[model samples]
Target: MKNYPQAARILVAIDCIIFGFDGKEIKLLLIKRNFEPEKGKWSLMGGFVNEDEDLSDGAARILYNLTGLKNIYVEQLETFGKARRDPGERTVSVVFSALIKIDAHDSEAVRSHNASWIALDARPKLIFDHEEMVARAIEHLKYNAALHPIGFELLPERFTIPQLQKLYEAIYNIPIDRRNFSRKLLSTGLLIDTGDKNNNGATKKATLYKLDTEKYKANFHSFWNFMPDSMKE
Candidate 1:
């Protein structure tokens, strides 16, 4: 090992992109910045990493501190290390993307940060590189939704077929043919009708369904098609 001069100190931070789905749209959780260099602007939940903490731990801690949510489905995204990324310090940031049910977490701490869920299509301008971070997170979500069953994370335990279709439509940002969509999803045999109906003032009650986890696990290989030529590599 070689010794160098004392001018090489670097700082590390963790930023979390928390994505939520209402029945209609994909939304992002944003906090109003309270510090200088972007004060009063919208930003992702983030903080400096403590000396003894792992990057994942730091990301989780920051999210919990801001939103009081723990054990969410978070995955490590790319690290951003552009030299001028932060004007206040030589900082490198490890970003994480999380998918969570919109109403599953504590809301008090989030309110303290002036946090709000904004629809992805109508998000406010964010501070720092947070906009880039969100773009990457959306890309990751789109890819993962095509290949895995992770889209269920954005929904409640039990949902109707229409609800499931709406979730996929929100992720894809396009209209899906109701007939084809219903045919494909029903043919999968991964959904079980619960013998119940969602009777929330609709003219006709729609049947509720839940995932057959065992079957989903067994047939996952044939359930998803991520290699479609239309998907960008």
Candidate 2:
């Protein structure tokens, strides 16, 4: 192999912006760094890309290590190559967007890593360019949620129509018409009536439904247009 002139060695890192939605609100998974230039401060879960591992595999490993969960929805959002982004070193980070069922993660693993689920509006000031990454993730989420059924990643296997509506409302931060929303959702044929009701409610219980896995998987890429014209932007 012919040797070329010396090239600058820079680090490549992976940062994940994990979003979770409960029946009420959307949340973010953040870690309080225990060691480094920004110790004891909140930041996105991340690590350096190992020399021997593929980028996607490295991201999955890091995510599993932090959340103790697998098979979660993950997508490569964008790459941040700003030279001065990381104060500890010259690093280019590939930011990833992830969504997981909030109640499914192992609490012990999250505690071990000093990570917590923070409300989107109440999140602490993050270190480095993490804030920018999160903003972009939210923008991407709103854009995608309007067109695809990606919001299902944050819900449980069985949920009520109201619960599903709440999740979408949380994502777009807007109110939805119950009659129209329910009618539109049922028209998709992607929901299966589970023959169960949410008995936990004090008032009248709402019927429960589950995703028709075959249909959801088959039509995931199709445009949903679930939101109104005013909210589509």
Model 2 lDDT per residue over 39-86, tens place = 999999999999899989988998899888887899999999999999
RMSD of each: 3.1, 1.8
What is the Cα-based lDDT of residue 78 in candidate 2? 97
Candidate 2: lDDT of 79?
A: 97
lDDT of each: 0.82, 0.89
Q: Per-candidate TM vs. native?
A: 0.87, 0.95
lDDT of 1 by residue, 49-114 (tens): 998999888988888887677887789999999999988899999999988888776778778888
State the lDDT at 69 in candidate 1.
74
| Candidate 1 to truth, TM | 0.87
Worst 10 residues of 2 by lDDT: 1-10
Residue 161, model 2: Cα distance from true site in angstroms: 0.5
| Candidate 1 ranges beyond 4 A from true positions | 1-7, 201-204, 213-223, 226-233
